[model samples]
Target: MIIEIKIPTPGESITEVELGKWLVDDGSIVSKNEEVAEIESDKATLTLVAPETGKISFKVEEGVTVAVGELACTIDTDAAGEVALDPPVAAQPKAEPETIKTEASTEKTSSADQRRIKTTAVAREIMEEHHLSVDDIIQGLQRIGKKEVEAVINQPTSTQKMESAPKNLFSRDESREKMSMLRRKLSQRLVAVKNETAMLTTFNEVDMSPIMEIRKQFQNKFIEKHGLKLGFMSFFTKAVATAMQFHPAINSMIDGEEILTPQFVDVGIAVQTPKGLMVPIVRNAESKSIPAIELEIKELAEKARSKKISVEELTGGTFTITNGGTFGSLLSTPIINPPQSAILGMHNIVDRPMAVDGQVVIRPMMYLALSYDHRIIDGKDSVGFLVKVKSLLEKPQLLLTDGKLPEELLLEL
Candidate 1:
């Protein structure tokens, strides 16, 4: 019996999905519940799995949008064992899935002639999306037919890629590729926030001496206890959470004419993944300890990077924090994520000369940028809120233990 595999519903709101990619080759026998394809909704990417062990075929190609309940592929239940094809076109020994990951340094063949690897229409799209070169993935490919350009990406050329080759006439300098739905969605949201919100970013410098001192003092002990690095994010998150109580508007947003203030602190940590930038919320960040915050942030970030972050985790945040410092940025104005009124941008720490009280001294300083929707937040509130965060971060002992540096992390109140 032939089992038709239809696109499963990602959510009630998600009516259509992009046929992202096929994990398994067309006409390949798959085991029951093996992941065969990728389908992306506006919210998240979902795995489309084989319903049963059989020879599978694609009903629709990748990069195309198909509605929910639409036929994506079919499985011939009996064809798994009996299917046969011409030599070099039939099943070869199954390669381990880990071996298929695209590597940067692709191998080169000595001959100028290009080799074509037989692949499904969907597999070709997957290769393109992953930026995998044919040479990187084609291991011992046995070819028998005429080579065609159905989905063949150009093999690397020997021509000079650097120095512009002394300005030639027939220089192929650029290429165009269609944007994915996720990218389009990101573009639309960014533009929408700019046009719709009365956004303005306030800049301030942080004295990192306190947090730096604490981390340096407890680096090994903290790691031993928490099993994770003592990063700057937890300190910032704690500072933001505490400061929100004094200046709720910094975390509040204008929903139409109404300004909605969330009592609970859900700080969205902006994580950049291979797919795109994703904000996964650390739920109730205000109530969590630095250790707890670090662990949650780690898990959420890993999930986001792996495309395992759920739609729920990606949505509903009171504020966002984006660290450009990780990529060596000295300072940058980060845009606010939508619905949230403000975003905090963290930058690289630099040892700079400063006047400490009556003496001139050097301190490790970091620039903090708060981009807020001016519609909901005032200059006084924004500045005050930032000052509070700055104060907490500067005195991380107060921020971590809340008011007093406890023998433990518990509040003194």
Candidate 2:
């Protein structure tokens, strides 16, 4: 029996996809539900798995664009169990012991030692004139003396330095490749964002000392309890969610000239994968605890990188957070993810002297940038939102009270 494998639809509107690569050799035996190829869509990359255990044959070549539901491959279930097995151990050849030749080994060692010893120009000439080798000269030296030690110290270090050679050598080769569907769509959306929205960026800095201290102090306990290490992204995601309460405008988006603001916060964490940058949404981020947020981010990021994430996991985010700090970026103005009003950029942390009270003290600090659509988000709101996020990150305890002091929340202020 032969089973056909077709290109699976990545989303409702996607009609075609590019065949990215073949994971298995043609005619190779594959198990049921085993991933055999990768399919690339505008939004995400998905794998095509075998419908049943069989020998698979490709119907479409890799890197070719094919319509959704098109036949990608076929599996011959009748060919199962035809794979040849390895020979028996008793029928294989036996091992033989290696014998060393002492004379040849000693000669090889002597030649190697002679090559390592540096000789002066005049010394080489006299050796050649006398038909002598470095080993012979060394064997002739019966006693070690101060003069011999000084001669050894004065010898040239490297033979390459003694020879002159041109240092200007480089390659001018170039190559081109067809862009994947994901990258092309990313280009279009990035251009659309620049042309369609009145995007503006606001910047602020956060003292990372507090968060670092908290992680260092409780990281072991947190990992023991959660089975995952606490990271800076969860803190930033939680802080953004809490800060959105103080400034809802940053979380709102424009829909056909009407500003549509949702009551819930679904923060998209931008994950960079080999295929491209994929932002997987963490739904209802406002209601999730730090450990919960960390675990979900880890799972989603792993799935995205492995090309196992679904299209539903990548959509419906109200806001986005991208940490350029992971790439050593000191600062960057992140572009807003379309349909979402804003994106927050986190950058590398550096220890710098800062003015605190009446004295200057060194603090670990990170710059934060919030890029939002100016059409719906006012300058005051963007700036205020970033400041609020910074404050929450600096005073992480305030994140528990929605970016407010515990006392203020207790007093109903």
Candidate 3:
């Protein structure tokens, strides 16, 4: 029996989805619940799984946007094992999933060649880290039976060649490929984020002494009960909410000539997923306890990695928090996630010697950056809000004593 895999509804009113990735190759056999492909709707990335045990078949190419309920792929349930999909001249896959492989090829290869690896945002970093030239990287981009084109020389080839290439690294003929639908959308959104906002970023240093002490005292106890670590994000999130209360403008949006302030805080926390960066919102963040916030955050992050986040979960965020510290960033002027007036960037915490009450001492310090719309939030409010967060982080007891703790935190039963 053949099983038809359609694009599952991401959420209400979402009519289409961008094919994000194919976890299984065309011929791989998969179990009923195993993830086969990833689809990106307007709000989130969703995993397209096999409906039953079968050999997966492609219905579309990567990067095509297909409407919900459209056939994304077909599975041959009766096939004893893996089924190799017939290349073009056979059948098409449902609106192509966003194939990162396609995007990698477009950025790295030329158009004449059809089969190439699409170099994604991370692929370039890999090339740089390995100190590889286009020629050195081109050889690995080829797919079997595809016409290969030599990457055209546009730069000073002689100069690059003279700089001593690595052993076993040689130029190979390769063809260019088109960008995946997801890659194009990702690029457009990031650019839109930069171009649409009156983007300006401010920076400040935070002393982590108070939060560190609090975490050290309660981390073990909290983890024992919650099954997760006492992370800094919960404290930072609460601090952001506390600060936003004083400067509501940062939590507001600009609708043409109007400045619409939100009564509640819906914070978007950036989570790195297998497909790309996904920001999942924690609704009513101001009212959630640290543990509750942490639990929700953990749940969202896990769903993001597993590609189960819903479109609604990824939309309607009033502000965003991106922790570059997780990736070892010392400082970053992050771009604002549009409409919302501000985004807070958290950096790595480093223990360094600093002056304390006229005496030098080593203390943990992390830099914080707030990127905001200059049109709505003045430099003063932005800076002050960051400072407010810093103060709360430096002394968390203020929030705890102020009834910010949820009733559940008091339960002993």
- Order the candidates by TM-score, highest first: 2, 1, 3
True-structure Cα RMSD, model 1: 8.0
Return the top candidate by TM-score: 2
Tens-digit lDDT track of model 1 for 236-262: 998999889889888888777888998
Please identify model 2 stretches exceeding 4 Å from their true place.
Answer: 31-33, 85-168
What is the lDDT for 259 in model 2?
Answer: 84
Candidate 2 lDDT over 198-249, as tens digits, reads 9889899999999999999999999999999999999999999998899999
Candidate 2, overall lDDT?
0.84
The TM-scores, one per candidate, come to 0.75, 0.81, 0.72
Candidate 3, residues 1-413, lDDT tens digits: the string is: 98788888888888888886787668555666767787876556778877787767899778788888999889888773433322242332243323225545654332223223333223334444544433454545522111112223233477687996666766686999655444566778779988777889999999998888888998899989999998999998888887787788899998979889988999999998756678999999988899999999999999888777887888889999999999999999998887688999999999999998999999999999999989888988998888888878887886774423445456731
Pick the lDDT winner: 2
The per-candidate count of clashes, in order, stands at 0, 0, 22
Model 1 stretches astray by more than 4 angstroms: 1-4, 31-34, 51-53, 77-170, 400-413
Question: Residue 130 in candidate 2 has what lDDT?
Answer: 50
1 or 2: which has the higher TM-score? 2
Candidate 1 local lDDT, residue 336? 91
Q: lDDT score, residue 165, model 2?
A: 70
